[model samples]
Target: MMTIRRRKTRKRRSPQKKRSRRRRSTKRGSQVKRRRRQAMTHRKKRRVKRRKKEIQTRRKRTLKEKVKLLVINLKMILLLKLKKELRVPQKTRQLQKNQPQKSQQLKNLPLLSQLPKNLPLKQTRFQQQKLRPTKSKPLFLLAKPRPQHRLQPQ
Candidate 1:
C-alpha cells in the first residue's frame, strides 16, 4: 500500500520543461553592422591569445616546484660543505706526519754520512752531472734510461 502511494506521488510531480529544436538565424544586416561584428570577433581572438600566453607563463613553474628545487640545491651545498669539513682533519694529520719525518731525516743526515763518504768520489760526481741532463728530457721518456751513445752537450 505504501509503494502504491509513493508511485502516485511520483506521477503527480510537474513535467520537465522541453527545449526548442528550431535552428536560430543570424541577421544579414547593413555593411556597418557586418563591420562591427567582424571587429568584435577580432577583439575576442586577441583576448584569447593574451589569456593563452598568461596560462603558459603560469604553467612554467608553480611555487611548490620552486621550493622543491631550492631545497635540493641547499641539500647539495650542505653535503659539499660536510665533505670539506670531514677532509680537513685528515689533510692536517697527514701534513703533521710528513713534517716530523722530514725533520728527522735532516737530523739523521750527519750520523748516516759515513756510508756516503765511502762511495767512489768520481762515481758520485758523474751521478750529479747525469741528473742535470735528465731534467731536460721529456717526462714520458724518463721511464726508460736514455742511451749512452745519444748523450748531448748543453
Candidate 2:
C-alpha cells in the first residue's frame, strides 16, 4: 500500500483595498479626525441649504420682476393704441376747429389722465358708509324686552 499524503487547505488573505478619503476620515480615523470630518460635512450641508434658499428667493423675485415688466409693457402698448386712435384726420381737424363748444365739453369730461394718480378704483369711504344701516345699535340690541311671564300664579 502506497503511503497517502494528506493535503492541508489554507485560506488565502485578500489584498488590503484602499479606503476613500471620506470613509477613511470618518470611519477608521481617530476620534478627532472623525469629529472634524463630521463638522465639515455639517457645515457643507448648511451651506448647501442656504444656497438653495437663496436660489429659491431669487427665482421668486425674478418672477415678480417679470410680471411687473409685463404689466409695464402692456400699459405702454395700451397708451400707444390710444394715441393712434386719438389721431385726427385733416377733415376731422377742420370740423373740430369749427366746434369750439364740443372741444370745451370734451375737455370738461373726466378722463383717466385728468384723475388723481392715487384715486381709489373701488367705492369711496363716503359711498361705503351709505350702504350701512343708519342705526348705531344692532337690531338685536334695539329689540324691546318681553314682559316676564308669572312663573307661579299669584
**Residue-wise lDDT of candidate 1 within 39-120, one digit each (tens)?**
9999999999999999888877676689899999999999999998887897796887677675575565434334333232
Write the residue-wise lDDT of candidate 2 on 1-154 in tens digits. Answer: 9989989797654455334223644444487798999999999999999999999999999999999999999999999988876886778878977877855755665555644444333555975564444446432332333334632366
lDDT of 1: 0.63
Q: lDDT scores for all predictions?
A: 0.63, 0.68
* Residue 74 lDDT in candidate 1: 100
- The residue-level lDDT of candidate 2 at 47 comes to 100
TM-score per candidate, chains pooled: 0.33, 0.39
